[model samples]
Target: MKNCCQAPARRLFAYPPTSKTPTPSADDTVRPQPTPSKQNRGRPHSGRGTKRPAIPALPNFLPKLNPGSQLVMDRIYSQLLLFQLFFTGSVVDTIVKNTNTFARMRSEAGKHFLWLPLKAEELHSYIALVIYMGLLGAKNIIDYWSGKEIYRLPFPKSVMSRSRFQAISWNLHLCDPEDDRENSQKKGTQAYDRLFKIKPLYNDIVSACKTYFHPDRQLAVDKRMVATRARIGIKQYMKDKPTNWGYKLYVLADSACGFTWNFFVYEGKSSLATGKGLSYDSVMQLLDLSLLGKGYQLFMDNFYTSPCLFMDLLAKKTLACGTIRTNRRRDQRGTIRWLRDGKLLFVKWIDTREITVCLTMHMAYDGDAVLRRVNNPEREWERRRIPIPVAVKDYNIYMGGVDLSDALIGYYNVLHKTTKWYKTFFHFVDIVVVNSFILHQHLSKAQNKNPLSQKEFRERLVSELATQSSTSEPSTSAISAGEPCCPEYFGSDAASGRRVCALCKLSGLKVKTPMYCTKCNVPLCLVPSRNCFRKWHTVGHS
Candidate 1:
């Protein structure tokens, strides 16, 4: 009699047991095997040519784009959709308007040393700055903005002034005037909220992620540590991680494509907890409620896997597979039997190298077994005789999706080394960029075009987002051109107050003067040897 639920172990090494002692000794514990039912014997076996079930092909999750479109073009169009859904025009407008208000208030309050007003163009430039820094991999903000070693392929000289970039970096605010906790005395309200300032933007990013793409049948839940040494309350330390100190995020992503569908930031002790424990709560938080009852298989690691969690997921019609720790299993005795590495029975194969146990609501007989090679120091390596369970193999295959998402984020991470706690908010922006890139790749593939690589993707994305001049108001040079004498000269006036002189600014000269031509309305210095007014309105400086 054999246990129908467990597989019979197969022989490896092509040799009989060295000693002919009955495998189970008098003192050794033995599992109780059930009588084999006639129906169970009638089913197909796992041996060669045993008529195994065919694996169903995975469905394409990419939506169809217009035919004959180039990948970069499609990517640009797809980015527009992503921005609209996630970082909408209204959202940008609110940020810009509120930022301007905050800047004015700061200047009025004498907190700002320089009168740096936040403008729409600078906001665009700020986004571009983050992208440029991510792509270039600079040591610091200074190194990224310096022109000494610019990468010619993507970065051009003087794309933006370093001082202006620095100013924007210092003044970037995601919250509105009302939400700014500058003077709030509510102790408990602000104490635990790590992301209180940028909560709105964070919520919008999450909402956009949920709305933009639908995940595949298989999903993975895992934790990621965003590297930072900042003194924030939400900072977590995982000594095993390459980045040991940082903020932790629980991400739910598509297994096959690594598209992040939903995510939850792990705050301190007050956060939600499942009936089973913290790990269960994390899995539940990341998994969207609407995805239930869809037969989606969720893959996790030992930290979150337990028989109770599996049963809960099974009750919701969602299947789960993971490497479970010994103590977490409900059938501790049955699970321990599979932990020993060797042959179990004549028909069923068990190898402890791959899996301890694979749990499914129904029999996991739909997928095929996976081949694994075993290495021996004394002899040539050979494939293990016993095959790995399909559920176990699928769990191994899809388990890295969240890690893969983290890897992509690392290539162009927006979070930099900073003392400020709010830099964590910028990490979410990096997620948006990575998610948008994923959407672009899928949409491009649907159009049968080769998608842009991550490097090229960021280059194009930054250029597109930053190229637009602000239309809401005139630039600082125009206002600082100091009152155009006539309406005809308004076109030539420099709106940017930061502009010293058109030639001086372009020539990288340090000269500064406020004089301008009354008719042409162009800013130029009137120094004894360097009168630039005539050259400003003329055909050529020469």
Candidate 2:
């Protein structure tokens, strides 16, 4: 709204006018009026050019144009709708109080300053952003504080201006104590002070927002991974080259209502260790716990099941339940009896290294007291082998009768909308789990509904997997003609398949070298050897 054409000067009728108008005696009788000047008629009657008023300029300036400025508002508005419906907006208020509320982050986590200038709040940008995004209803930063959106959000335009973007991107509050602060003192220097200095009065004022509105009760561990090429290619195992693809971040959020307990970012190989492996070391590391004990219930799939792994979990006091390897291939001489149909039956297999193990825990439960009952009086819980869907169950054997697979369950479920879309399955599962926890803690909880304890939760989960098959009609075809034989949740690129070690394929090649088997950490050689590795690698073979 600029006035491109300056208005023509007005002929005023006030004292000492730029142009003179008829002036009558102070107490004279009314006289005939003359034609009025068009401009002077509506113009304020003032001393005219004799005393001009000063106009001040407004101060938001930006050299770069924000591309998303146009859609920001609509995006925010729509996203806000979804966020409001799902999450209780208290996390936003909690985020605003990070430093001011926690108080410990500043003391423990924010110990050092960095070469880049910073404030206290910048130290917790990752966590704060999660809380802010989940609670504030902004999908990502592009939609929030946008020039067109947040500028109208009762905040000034400078907050989203292009200059501020560059100014703040450099580790603003990520300061290291021994960092070169003095270097920033001079102009044209990349040092902290000179690189981009805020006026001295406002310096060091960077800290957690003093005005955060929510308390701990309303807060949750919020997380968001901004797409990045590196993380996408590596963390999520998206094999596509990083020529242009951005990353995807998986976050654990508590928008439902709880404190943020843990959060992390994996640049590429998605949750291989944490989500799939259920590795004690991985879980402990992910939770940032030191010697938090090894025993804990690890809920996961077959990719994580192993006797050694099971023992590890038990050592840590963790109960692991999922599918287990029956090892029926080899007819060992030893007889292993399993409790079946309330009777001990001798099976052909034995507990031996010759037969490998593979299993997954579909659900995990732990508490002060434990109780379980079998639904069928004849079938014992230990012998009742609840099966996953056939498609996913035989995923590894899809190509042939049998092949090694980190999982077979994926093939059993095509994960279509008619079937269970992986996204919906996982999302539904997440909701069920989180909300169940909440229900147990705060909601009206019901004791196990089945008085007879007919079905274990895992069996129930498997039953839910039976598909309507098709959105229109229940059909068995999972992959529509020639569609990649992979689950939607399995990730897009099939090239992310695990790799075979050079030595594993070198029986006919050059000299073999000694290597510690990753799973067992024991010295093992290449040719004709199946060595046990102590530490679990999510990529089993690779």
lDDT for predicted candidate 2 compared with the true structure: 0.25
Per-residue CA lDDT of candidate 1, range 123-200, in tens? 766777677778777676656534454533334223455555654565566777666664344545635465666766
- Per-residue alpha-carbon lDDT of model 2 for 213-277, expressed as tens digits? 11111111112222233321232333442313332222222222331223233332333344434
**Candidate 1 segments whose C-alpha is farther than 4 A from its true place:** 1-84, 147-158, 182-184, 189-192, 271-275, 291-293, 327-354, 361-384, 470-542
- Model 2: what TM-score? 0.26
Q: Against the hidden reference, what TM-scores do the models get?
A: 0.68, 0.26
Residue 77 of model 2, lDDT score: 27
